[model samples]
Each structure stands twice: as C-alpha cells, then as structure tokens.
Target: MGRSPCCDKVGLKKGPWTPEEDQKLLAYIEEHGHGSWRALPAKAGLERCGKSCRLRWTNYLRPDIKRGKFSMQEEQTIIQLHALLGNRWSAIATHLPKRTDNEIKNYWNTHLKKRLDKMGIDPVTHKPKNDAILSNEGHSKSASNLSHMAQWESARLEAEARLVRESKLRTSHSSSPSLQHSLIGTSASSSSSSAPVLPSSTRYLDHAWNNGSSTSTVATRMSDLESPTSTLSENNVPPIMTSVIEFVGSSERGMVKEEGEREWNKGFQESTTHLGEYKDGMENSMPFTSSLHELTVTMATTWGSSTTSAHAHGHVSEDGFTNLLLNSNSDHRSLSSEGGGDSNNNCHGNSSDGGNGTGNELYEDNKIYWNNILNLMNCSSPSDSPMF
Candidate 1:
C-alpha cells in the first residue's frame, strides 16, 4: 500500500512559517473559513504542507488563541488534565478552549513536568521514581501493587515538601497576608510539629485514588477541585490526606531545609525541634513507602495480636520504629538476577520445619507464607498507623 498522503513529503515547503506565509494563511481562512485542514494550505496560496499550515494557524494565528502568560487557573487545568490523560494533548485541549494542543504540550514539557521531577515525582506515573520501591517489588504481585501505591503517596509528600519550602521562601519576602495564607493552607494556631497539608490538586489525586476512579473519572474530579481563586484554602484539604501529609511531608523534608541554611551551623537538636524527629528506621526508613500498604492492611485487619505480630517478623530499630523492611526483605529478590523470574521454584521440594511433615500442614504453611509477613502495626488507619 502507498504511504498515507499526510506523511508523503512531495513538494511542500517545510520550515519556519514567515510573516508573509502567516498572513496568506490567515487571510485565506478569515475570508472563507478553514474548510478542510489538509486542503487549506494549497487554497491559501502557501507552499507549506497541510500539517504545517494547520499547526501555524491553530497554535499562533488562530483568532481565538489567547496569547500571553497562562493564568493560574489555566495552569491548574493543565496539571489536572495532564495527570489524567498523560500526553494526549489534543484531548486535554478540548476543555481548555482558547489554547492549542501544541501550546499545552510545550508548556508541560518545558514547565510542570520539570517541576515535578525537581520535587522527586515521576511525571508519567505521578509517583516517586525511587529504585528502592521498584527493587522491593521483586516478583510478588500483591506486594508490587501495594508498593506502587506507596510510591504514589511518597511522591505526593515529596512534592508537598518542596512546596512548603517554596512557600516559606515566598512568605519571607512578601507581606501579602492572603497569598501567604493560601500557601500555608493551615491555621497558624495549628501545632508547629504538624506537617503542612497538600494543595487542593494533590488532595484531589488522593481522592481519585481512594475511589478507584478511571482516567476519565479522574479528569472529572480534577474539575471539581477547581476554584475561582488560584490558591485553594485548607478547608478544601481532606482530613485523611492532611493527617498523613503533616507527618511525612514535614519531618524529613525539614532536614533539607536546615541544610539549605547551613551557613548558620545549626545543631541537630535545633533541627529536629524546628522540624520533626527524623526517626527514619525501617518503617520510617525512607519516611514514605515502607509502611503504607502494610500499615493500611494492619489497620483493616485483626488488632489483638499487634505486639506479637510485630515481634514475629520485624526487628526494632534504634529509633524504636518497627523496621519491617517490606516483609523483612525476604519477599523480593533482585530483578537483575538471571533466574529472577522464578527464584523460589526449586524450594517446593524442600521439607517443612519438622522434616517429617505431611502434605496438609505444608500446604497451609505455604498459604500463610505467601499471604504476607506479619501484619500487626498498632494504628487505626493509614495516617495513624505506626510507622512500618
């Protein structure tokens, strides 16, 4: 079959569209409207191809195009849309009426995506890009999924921490109470030890996650997070998200803040007090992913054996946080291994603890072994659960 007509570069000029070319294209469209983009270039007396002409008109010369710095509202829309749709700029552009897909794509690549990376977030998954999380997944399906969600939560905290630092800097220079208030998101009367809550958009992502919404639904919820003001109030932040955010987002990130001010030579005691204690043991290990899924399961399951369960699998770190270390580091093997795919296949022939065990007991032991390590973190929910 012949190549698609669109891709065939026959005799069309392909390069920057000059002012004269733009004028000719614009004049043709203005006089008789853009009938068909593929045929419009030829009719407009331009040497450019249809794709080039279409891009030039839509991105630059369109009568409805809004040319200037993007307002905060537009920015939020773009962030929310990009989160839901990934790189589908054309679809993202439909809701953003005066903007072109090309414009939104460029803005994302040049701006928001970069900021997310600086904040330790993976722009594609909207999750943390830490190798520890990926390596920890190993080959277990349940552990892998939980670890992925944990990664998302971690990424969120990381981004929020950056925002808090930025907000602190912004507040230091400007006396605008309202701008400061919006950025702070919580009352000054709140406990100084409390972590700063996430922005409305972050909270919205959490909401979408909790509800198990699809991409389309995620886009819809993004619209609900909108407000006439660029800065959303703390009232808009959900309690579940805030309770967790205040802890994880504030503590470790404080270490970075203190380092950013090292010229003063602040002591460790002063840093912990100004921030929160960095008791990042196994559970507090990275201050993010270690305890999420496991803790959530613990809170949702039986609670009477919490202490016994803790002792069964994990050890206590110096900081007193249970360093479960994602099922005590036994669930995962390094994916880099040649036989990483089935690391345990040979183990099926081995006998049980007593060596003379029958098949029934071995079956139950196998079942329990794979269910999960020990799940007895004493807490009420993901936010309140004891670290790891």
Candidate 2:
C-alpha cells in the first residue's frame, strides 16, 4: 500500500495561520513535544495538515526564531557562504545559529538575489557580470593572477606537510637508540668521544626538514600579508615573502580595476539608452542626480550603521547605484582610478537630466540588462556559453 497523505484532506485550514490555530498547534507541540510532524495534526486536534503545522512552527512560530531583519554581518556571511555553497539553503542555515532554511531561501529570493542582480553581480556565480568584457579586452590577467596565488598557497601547504612528516620521522629515529647508532655510525671506540658521523641519507633528511620549516614560515607570512588587519609592527613579516604577496595583491587589484571600468561603462550605456527616450514632462521633472544621490547616501548611511539595514537597503542600493552611474556625467570613466578621478567628477556634475526621454526606458531596460549580465556571467565555461 502507498503512504497516506500527511493529514486528512477534509476541513483543514490552509493559507495564513490564525491565532486560535496557532494556539492549538503551539499548545499541542509545547505539551506533547512534537514527535512526528506527519502524525502531529491528528493527535493535536488541529484542523490543519501536518506539513502546514510543521512549516508554521518551523518557519514562523518557533520560539527561537529570530523574527526581525538580518544584520550586515549576517548578510556578508550569507553572501560569502552562498558563493561557496550555492543554493544549499539548509546547509547555509547550519552556519547561521537561529535561522531556518526556508526563511533563508525566502530572503535570498526576495531580497539578496535582487540586490546582487541590481549590482551587476551574478547571484549564482557571485562574480562581476562584466567578466566577458574584461576577457575580451585581452585580460587573461585576473585568471593568471589567481592561478599564481593558488600555486604559492599550494606550495606552502605542501612544504608544511613535508616538514611535519620529517619531524615525525626524526623523532621516531632519535627515540630508538639502536637505529640512531646504526644510522650515525657511533662506535664503542668513540665511547666518551665526540660527534658521530652522520649518514648521507640522514644529512639529506635533516636538510629537507629545515627547508620545510623555512617554507612554512614563508607561508604564514604570506597569509598575514593577505589579511587586511595585518599591521607593520616592529617585527614585520619577512621582506621577501611580503614582496611576493604585494605582487599578487597588485595583480588582483588590476583585475578588480578592469571589472569596475566595464561595470561603469555598461551602466553609462544603459543610462544613455534611457535618456534618449525620456518624455518632456518626465525629463523636466526628473531630479535625476539629486534623487539618486539622496537615495544612495540614505542607503549607505542606513546600512553602514544598522543590522536591519541589510534587509531594508540591500536591493535598493544595487538599483540606485546602477541608475546613479547612468544618469551621471558622460565623462565618468575609470571607476577604480586613484584620487577619486572621473567617478567623483561625474557624481558631482551629472545631477541634471540632459533633456532626453530615456529615463523611463532606462529604468525598464535595467531589469533586462541585469538578467542578461547574470546569464552571461553564470555560464559554466566556454562549451555552455550563452552568446555563442
């Protein structure tokens, strides 16, 4: 016989949870302690499906459920973990102390995903959408840079492992006097005598062990270099290793710079397209720069100070930033340039509409632009390329 439905189909409440229904479910679970969700509704005298009861309790009414907004730290953790683990919401919830997988999934769908979309980032891949543009400009640069970094980290890890193995071997050999004597050639004639002759293998092993130790030290220094909190104390990281990390950081910065430039250009093109089709009344009334700048400043200030701001401004800024980039100046190039170059200049100058009817069209096109960018960036290598 097949398994039955979780609860009887007749006369059960379905949609939103009512107070009386919540009381019945909560009272039943509180007293009886909820053994099996599939069997709970019938036993509890609740007119709801067991699955509904379970979802209601788990997602909404659970005593430990954190009902408010997620903090900035939580948002960052979610983003980073999502980048690493994809849509395994249940798995992601494990790292989060008081959150449910369902809640996380909903938040990502309603909030985080939209935010990433607006920011020209691929929600799935967590990479800049302009990767193709960067690549087309003959920048195999970031890939090579990341590859070299991975090599250095790999080498360091390997060297540390080798050192540990050699240390174990030496400790074992030294612990057994018979083996030590045989290996070192310590004779009875040298009883009270000086140093024993070390075997060639033993000498080589000692040298290997020392080299491994040195390599581990270099690796630690590299790690410190990569960390933002690291400071130059009286005892700084070794100069040679610092140089290596600096080189890697420089390459990574170049890649970021290239990606930023492409994003700014894409934003500008999108804005221009909108400006062209803008209606006379709308264009005249459009306080483009002031409105977007106020939005951006408000969002930045809000998010910079509060945990709940993550949920509030998360999606808003992505859309706002893109729009701001668009309606701003034509000369707003080189987003990652030092000393607040064209970006600041554009931000200050491009506050008024250029009397074009493109604003509404630009807003409509924003969604499509982000979707296309996301699709392109999320493509898994060349064989699955969307454009091709």
Measured against the true structure, the TM-scores of the candidates, in listed sequence, are: 0.38, 0.36
lDDT of 1 at 378: 14
State each model's CA lDDT, in order: 0.40, 0.41
Candidate 2 residue lDDT tens string, 319-347? 32223323321222122111222223322
Error of 1 at 200 (Å): 32
**Model 2 residue 284 distance off true place after TM-score fit, in angstroms:** 42
RMSD per model, one decimal: 17.8, 23.7
Q: Give the least accurate 10-residue stretch of model 2, judged by summed lDDT.
A: 247-256
Q: Evaluated with lDDT, which candidate comes out highest?
A: 2
Write model 1 residue lDDT over 1-388, tens digit each, in one string.
8757773667788778889998998778666555567888778888777888777876888665656665544554455445434575754554354577788889889976886577565677544456235433222332343443343334333344344345544553464433332232211111244542433444454454444334234434433433333243334333322222222222211111113223222321221121121122122222122222224322212111222343232322222222333232222212111122233322211111111212232223322322222211111113422343
Which residue pairs clash in candidate 2? 274-358, 275-358, 277-357, 277-358, 278-357, 278-358, 279-357
